[model samples]
Target: MLLYGSTDSGHSYKIRAFLLLTASPHAYQWIDLALPQSHRLAAFVAASKFGEVPVLLDQGQAMCQSNAILMYLAQRVGKLAGAETEWQGVLEWLSWESNRIGFSLPNLRYALRWSAQPPEVLHYLRQRVLADLARLDAAVSAQDFLLPSGPSIADLSCSAYLFWLDQVGIDESAYPHLQRWLARLRALPHWQHPDLAMQAVAPDTSLARDE
Candidate 1:
C-alpha cells in the first residue's frame, strides 16, 4: 500500500495518523502541490482525479477524501464499529467533523498563516471557528472520547485541524475538555506529531492557498 499526501496537509495527516494507530504498514509518497505543474502531472491526476492530497493506494485501488478514507480504514481494522448505535454515533461525529470543525478551522488557519484575506474576512472566519470549537468542547466534555466505546475515527477526523489551533493563536484554555482529549490522543503508543509522522520529500509552502 502507498499513501499519497503532503506533509503540511491536515487531511493527509488524518489518514496517516489512523494508519499508524492501527500499526498498518504502508509506503508514503509525498506530493508537492506547490511545485509548478504538479497538478498537471498525469500520474498524480490518475491517483487523485480531484488534484488533492491524501489518496490512499491499496493494491491497485486509489482512495480519496479524508473522512471516507478514515471510515474505510476503521472498517478494515475493525476499530470503528462496535454496536450498531455506537457505529451510528461515530458516523454522526464524522459528519460533524467534516462539516463543522474540518471546514472552518483549517480555513481560519490558512487565512491567519498564509493568505492575504482582509481583516473582516479573517474576523468572520474566526467567529465561526469559535462557535464550532465550543460545540466540539461540549460534545467531548462528558467523556474521554466522542463515544462511550472510546476513541474512534471521529476523534482522529476532528482532531486533525484542531492540533494546529495554537499556530493560529486560538486559545485552548477556554475548552479544557478538548485540550484533555488531545492530551489523551498524544499519549497513545503509536501516536506521533503529524509533522514528524508525515514527512514530504519537498514541503509545500503554498498549502495555505485555497484549492
Candidate 2:
C-alpha cells in the first residue's frame, strides 16, 4: 500500500494515525504542495481528483478523501470501524466532524499559521471553533469514546487536527474532557505524533502554505 500526504496537513495525519494504530504495512509519499502541479508525482496527480493529499493507493486501487479512506481502512482491517449496529452512529459523527469541528479548526489554523485573515473573519472562525470544542467536550464527558461501542473512525477523524491546538493558539487545557479523550487516544498502542508519523522530504519554504 502507498499513501500520499503532506506532513503539515491534519487531514493527512488522520490516515497516518490510523495506519500506525493498526500497524498496517504501507509506504508514505510526501507530496510537496509548494511545487508546481507538473512537478508532483504523476501517479499522485492522476490519483487525486481534487488535487489534494491523503490519497491512498492499494492493490492498484486509489482512494481519495480522508474520512473515506479511514472508513475503508477500518473495514479492511476489521478495527476501529465500530460494531455493525453502531455503523450509523459512526457515520453521523464523521459527517458532523467534517461539517463542524473539521471545518472550523483547520480553517482557523490556516488563517493563523499560513495566511492572515481579516479580524472579523478570524473572530468568526474562533467562535465556531470554541462552540465545536464545547460540543465535543460535552459529548465525550460521559463516554470513553464518541460511540458506545468504543473508539471508532469518528474519534480518529475528529481528533486529527486537535493535536496542533497549540500551533493554532487554542488552549487545550480549557477543554478538560477533550483533553482526557486526547490522552486516551495517545495511550493507544503504536500511536505516534503526526510530525513523526508523517515526516518526509522537506518542501520549498518559499511557496504558500497548504490548507
Candidate 3:
C-alpha cells in the first residue's frame, strides 16, 4: 500500500500515525501542497476521488478520507470497533468527530493563516474551541476512552485531533478532564503518536497572548 500525504497535515498524520503504530509496512510518498501542485493532478484526483491527502491504495483500490481509511484498516486487521454492549457508543463518538471535532478544525487553520488578524476576529473561534473542549471533556470524563474500557476506532479518530487541539493553545487546562484523558491516551501501548500533527500547528496568538 502507498499513502500520499503531507507531514504538516493533521488529517494526513492521523493515517500515517496509525500505519506506523500498527507496524504496517507501507510505502509513503509525501505530496507537497505548497502550491497545489499534486492536488490537481488527474491521477491523484482519480485515485482519491476528491484529491484529498492521506489517500490510501489497498489491493489496487484507492480509498480517501482519513476516518474511513482508519476504519477500513482497523477492520482489515481484526480490530472490532466496539464491544457488543457499546455499539452505539462507538457510533456516536465517530459521528461526533465528523461534526463536533470538525468544527474546531477550520478555525484552527484560519488562525494559522491569519495570525496577524485582530483578536476580536478570532474570538469566535476561541469560543467555539472552548465549547468543543467542554463537550469533549464531559463526554470522556467517566470513561478512560470513548468506550468505557477499551480503545476503538472512535479513539483513534479522535486522538490526532485532540492532540492538535491541545497543542494549538486551546487552554486544555480549562478542561481538567480533557487534560487527564489526554495524559491517559499518551500512556497507551498501541497509541498512535501525533508528532507531525502537533508540529504542524503552532501556538497561535490567541493561545499565547490571551492565554
Candidate 4:
C-alpha cells in the first residue's frame, strides 16, 4: 500500500495516525500541494475525488478521502471501520464524525488561521465552535468510548478534532469526559507522531488569552 499525503494537513494526520496505531506495514509516499508534483497528475486525479492529500493506493487501486481510507483499512483488519454486527452506536457516531468533527471543526481551525472575516463574524464562529465542543464533551462523558466500549473509527474520527480543538485553546477541560477521553487517546503508542503532537499545532497561549 502507498499513502500519499502532505505533512501539515490534519486530514493527512488521520491516515498517518491509523498507520502507526494499527502497525500496518505499508509504504508511505508523501506529496505536497505547495510544490509542483505528480500528486496533481491525471493518474492521481483519477484515483481521488478532490485530488487532495490522504489518498491511498492499495493493491494498485486508488482510494481517496481520509475517512473512506480509514474505513477500508478498518474493515480489512477486522477493526473499527469494518463490519459491525448491528445498526447501533458505531454507525451513528461514524456519521456524526464525518460531519461534526471532520468538517465543521477543521474548517473553524482553518478559518482562524486565515481569518479575513469581519471581527463580528469571527467572534460568532468562535461561539459556534465552543457550542460544538460542549456537545462533544457531553457525548463522550456519557460513554467510555464512542462505540462497543473500545476504540473505533468513530473515536479516531472524533477525537482527532477534539484534540486539535484542545490545541487551539478551546479549554476542553470543562468537559470532564472529553478531557479524560483525550488522555486515553494520547496514551496510545501509535499516536506518537513526531511532527504531529499537540505542541506542534497548539494555539499560541499568548494570542489565545488576549480575548
The sequence of per-residue lDDT tens digits that candidate 3 reaches over residues 57-136 is 77778888878888787777656466767767776776787676666655565575645557775776667777777887
Give the CA lDDT, 0 to 100, for residue 109 in model 4: 72
* CA shift of 161, model 4, Å: 2.7
For residues 18-85, could you state the per-residue lDDT of candidate 2 as single tens digits? 88898877777899888999999898899898999889887678889999999999998899999999
Clash count list over all predictions: 0, 0, 0, 1
The reply for model 2, stretches above 4 Å from the true place, is 201-211
Top candidate when judged by TM-score against the true structure = 2
Residue-level lDDT of model 4, residues 49-112, one tens digit each, is 6768777777667787777777777877665553456335666766776766666677777677
Where in model 3 is the C-alpha error above 4 Å?
38-45, 113-121, 190-192, 196-211
- lDDT of the candidates, in the order given: 0.81, 0.89, 0.67, 0.65
Instruction: Return the candidate ranking by TM-score, descending.
Output: 2, 1, 4, 3
TM agreement with the true structure for every prediction:
0.90, 0.93, 0.78, 0.79
Off by over 4 Å in 4: 36-46, 81-83, 86-88, 197-211
- TM-score, prediction 4: 0.79
Across 86-164, the per-residue lDDT of candidate 1 in tens digits comes to 8888888889888888888888888877787988888888888999989888888898888887888888988988878
Q: In candidate 4, which residue pairs get closer than 3 Å at backbone N, Cα or C atoms, i.e. clash?
A: 75-82
Q: Evaluate model 4: give its lDDT.
A: 0.65
Q: Kindly indicate the candidate among 2 and 3 with the higher TM-score.
A: 2
